[model samples]
Target: MFECFLEIAFEAEVLTEEHPELQELARQLVHEDPATRPAAIQELRDMIYERGECAPRRMDDAFLLRFLRARRFVVPRAHKQLVRYCRFLEQYPELYRDVDLWGLARVGCAYEGCMLDRPGVGRVTILRFGTWNPDDYPVEELVKVGMAMMEIGLRSPKMQVLGGTVIVDMAGITMKHVATLTPTIAYQIVCLMGLAIPCVMHSCHIVNYNWLLNTFFFLFKRFIPKKAWKMIHFHGHDLESLHQLVDPECLPPRYGGTCRHHATIGTWFNKIRKYRDESFDRDMKEFGWVIKE
Candidate 1:
């Protein structure tokens, strides 16, 4: 996640530096009367390219690493919100694990007035949300929201999803028929995407004799992919309140090679563990993971 954030920060900075004129044009559009800005910006782009100006420089990995290191001491306010949200998840594992934690983080960060509103930072924020909950919402909704947020972050931009199929129908379809056929069609569609539905189990965690964890686990299991289930890193005081997902003795047999850590995101966490020592420790402490430093 940190690496992804750094990449976006560098991209934003590089784009701005390479295209100062474009950036100014975008600013002008924002300041102009709404009706004229769109066309004026288009005209500006054409005029610039016609003059044989060099294309903007693309963001590279080294630049991003440097930017992140430079900004290391000045943690974004949004990051603080993210840490708080992660701590919340640790405390109430059942309530937050499957509840769009990244979405909650993004909203929390936005509300907290983070510099993430700046170009590259904003893209990093979106990408983090995407990684945390790739399938939390419908694809259509994700595309719509993601595009809007990207526009806000990348100032002068066009979003295009290449090499993907899109089907558009203008025919007026009745709501009842569309609703009736949607699930069946959606099920069929998954086969085309080369995916298989995995087995899911309904389990619960009991915290303080309360069934909150169990209830949340049920909902989370429904929304998230089975393979990514272990991304929820539990912490906090009420271990007894939480429910175990699977019995150690009853572990499922794997047909192929498998690691002890099954989830991809969990694997990523392990890979970046060294780089995130401070952030990880701070998060752990905040979430009641009482470890002696």
Candidate 2:
């Protein structure tokens, strides 16, 4: 299964009728019927106009589709999520401040966006947060890094449809790191991922867990919803167990995988920047994240 995907070559593009495989997958997973897509999108658009509280920056088919797919083509639910998303971003002005590729890399979280062979897992995002230093890197900046990665990854129609898996490596996490997660920050992070983001969160795999990580999760469990909670799997130092859900061939050596490509922050950011279009800058404007050349 792993080798089968390696030959396909990942080419990021917006969802279209040309991609029958992905379209079929979207239909099966998210109840997206092409014949009814325009109607659904318009219905959500109408709701947006009716509410008048959360108007999208751009009301194109692509942009609205993200919210629609996240809610499984349910227009009302998608409209609600969009409202929440806009409200959340408007509320948290600080999370988007002073964020860029350099600052994010210094936070010590490496992110890699790659196509996967597995069904239901279109893209794999490997987030290594063990090297994070609370003293030097604030939790807010870390959140910015996450938002940046997600924004970049979601540009791919494949990711929007098949959804993606988040691998959280907590190997070098310490008590100090755990302490930085204030109750407010915890709730915000939960809302950003679980509620506001118009991306399909298939599942999250937390590996290399420990007591300190447990302490952080104690605060997290309160803010996290039960539905999202069910998608999370904890693997305390068991790479083999992690491999059961995710194909190790896509992972690096650190996670007991044979892949040689390291998902360093610089590499990830650089690639996204190179591949990013104008929307990348436009999207970050709300958070004041300007991509400097």
- Compared with the true structure, all predictions reach lDDT values of 0.27, 0.71
Instruction: Indicate the residue-level lDDT of 182 in model 1.
Output: 39
> Which consecutive 10 residues in model 1 have the weakest lDDT in total?
158-167
Top candidate by lDDT = 2
Q: What TM-score does each of the candidates earn?
A: 0.19, 0.84
Cα RMSD (Å) between model 2 and the true structure? 3.6
> What is candidate 1's lDDT per residue for 96-139, written digit by digit as tens?
12232123223221111112222211111101121222224343
User: On residues 60-134, what C-alpha lDDT tens digit does candidate 2 reach at each position?
Assistant: 888899889889998889998899888887778666655554456555444555544356665667766567666
Runs of candidate 1 with Cα error greater than 4 angstroms are: 1-147, 150-213, 237-293
What does candidate 1 score in Cα RMSD to the true structure? 21.1
